[model samples]
Target: MAKKAKKIDIRSDGREFDELREIKIQAGVLDQADGSARVDWGITMKRIAVSEKTYNKVESLREQFYIIPRGKGGKKYLVDVPAKLLDKIGDEFGDYEVVGEHFKGNVAIVAVHGPREPIPRHVADPYRAVLRFRYTMAPFSVPERKRPAPGRREIEISKVSREALQGVVFANEYPMTAIDIFAELLSADAGTRVTAITAASVALADAGIPMKDLVAAVAVGRAYGHLVADLTKFEEDAPDAVDFPMAVVPRTEEITLAQMDGRIAKKDLDELVELGIKKAKEISALQRQALKEKYQRVVENEQ
Candidate 1:
């Protein structure tokens, strides 16, 4: 667990500009991979490896964007550890909708694979498009962590993560092809899943998977009863925050994910969503800028 946030030095100007941290990109970090890059955005970082395999389902070649959803090779819905964590996530989220993309400082690596079997009909939900994610903490991600095992908090974040992302996927298109996005966290931040989802989208795109749009998330936390755009792990533990772990995608300019764990008035719901949507767009814009910069370098070097 982290401590609450303290003040930081703003620019010389009196304006309190939300200090944008550095986003460092290292390309081809994996020697054997067809495509791999490590994204270090401020406290957030993800090391993604992209490799391609032939698909027997030639019919699905039309999908230029795909999302590879994977878990810890098990069923997690309403299960043991995940459920308990979800309960706590609910407790924290009850107060406010922490909006934005990615975990605070989590690092993930994603890999893409081939056309697999379709999901069985029995387990599929009629109302929801399923997006699966597995979140783990490295043996040394945190200050006092080990064993490389996830705790209740990780499970809880996974549960809500699908909701944050379902609206952005086109699962019906490539019915059976599993876009496997595997993330091994070398570090833990508040926005790992959001980071993973962003990385997953890029990995899927690199794998030639198509989608309607790119989705991104950011977390907003309350401190001293004040709404902060992105909350660090330490600040999240602060009692002032009535909400925990909120993610939003800016594709439709509306909130697709909302969850809380503390006390808040019902009237505040719309306000929180509005704030979340607003910040999500800002984060999305930054992601697009990063993507543009990455691709531009590729083009320039090719020339």
Candidate 2:
């Protein structure tokens, strides 16, 4: 028996499925970081890339890079890329940088530090490099101050975020290393997780980490039985709402992260996942453009 889809009429800002709130992102906002990016969604800071001298010091960190797989047997193809080409695909880290608020208001910041040496030594794995994520909300991030500590929720989100981003990174390329990401919720909002993921991707690219593709994320929810994109804090709390956040490698359409609250039918889930992919691809394009613009500036400055 087939069940009919219910009509949903609720909306916070009358945004359609294909429409998202105003989005703005700028890279290299911070001069100190190896790479930084800022978005109206919030801010992000990154540290990556090394000087020719520094490269010599950490030269052992470099490893073979691969691209998107093709053909049936799934045998991966490797390419011989020079240093410039390494930068082209974000294989090599460049200067560190940071990004801050362009539009005021409270927004999250996603910060990444190091493809460098891993501290403590114990956490380092001999077989492959490791990636760790810490998701935190500041005391003043919300209307009411939160406890200044990493709670259970933060721990859970951090674990999930690491898992989500791990797939995109060439961890094996930096064996015995650690890539640490800190996503701070400076301005609390509904989709901070998604915002952090998007910002983090830009930071990684800015840092010049080798990657197959950039990651993009968005949250979708069912309000009044209708699907919507980029759920705000208000919409996320709506009664009976189904909130789902997802991260994807747009070019490959590979889902790296997905989290859902509230039950949904299999058919609805499929539809929402497709919708998420569409939105993520759009965001990914913007990410690529940001990197392109940043590098263009670097080239111009060098000249």
Candidate 3:
């Protein structure tokens, strides 16, 4: 018979097992990217950008804009406009009704580019869009200034975060093109991978990319043998800690990204997943609210 896992009192700092660390997602930190967001959790801060795709033709071909229904039970509308009108449309109204909730630090930077023109020819695909991602941490982003450039850790994160987002984006719409995502750690934080994924989803929407739904992510860990949502550096470094990071689409309740470290009992898996999903929904709500607030500002500026 297998030995049973020991149960330990996980509560520390007066927190409940289901409670998350304090979180804040702030959108619109930098205007240069098609969309940008910042998430602050504990001591970490993360900034992300979703930029306009590079191909002019791809952007010009789209002929519609989104709007919520006018009244109760009214269907939401996608008003078709002339292709030429889209050409006349400015960059200001691109984000529409999107927002990001929160996560951060070890300052990871992930940039998603393209859905534009394909370059170099060989990498282009005829049937669907090509997405590429790169993740890196800055030399100055850590407590001890570290060497810059891509390393094994950076590469691993890039791949996982990309996978987390691939299912949600409407990649088929831009065949023969490439969409690139880049994430850099501007500072060190325990949950940077999840934070980057969360921010990237908002950035894609902000850039007006077609997506089935937005993605949100968060980390859950076992501390003192108790399941906890949103682990911090302190908890992550704990000798008994077990970490699980996940990304999901709230509309479909689909999990696009999930990774685990340390050990978990088969019986405990269900509760951990439940906790992560519940928190993901909460985070998704905040993302929508953020977008609404951002668009509100644009409306005010226009008036």
- Candidate 1 wrongly placed segments (more than 4 Å): 1-38, 43-104, 114-131, 266-269
Highest lDDT against the true fold, candidate: 2
- 2 against 3, candidate with superior lDDT: 2
TM-score of 2: 0.73
TM-score of each: 0.61, 0.73, 0.72
Of candidate 3, the 10-residue stretch with the lowest lDDT total is 63-72
lDDT score for residue 177 of model 2:
90
lDDT scores of the candidates, listed in order: 0.47, 0.67, 0.65
Per-residue lDDT tens digits for candidate 2, residues 137-242, read: 8898776889988988888888877888888888888889988877776776577788778877887788778888889988886755577787755556556568
Worst 10 residues of 1 by lDDT: 75-84
Q: Local error of candidate 2 at 303, Å? A: 7.8
How many clashes does each candidate structure show, in the order listed? 35, 10, 20
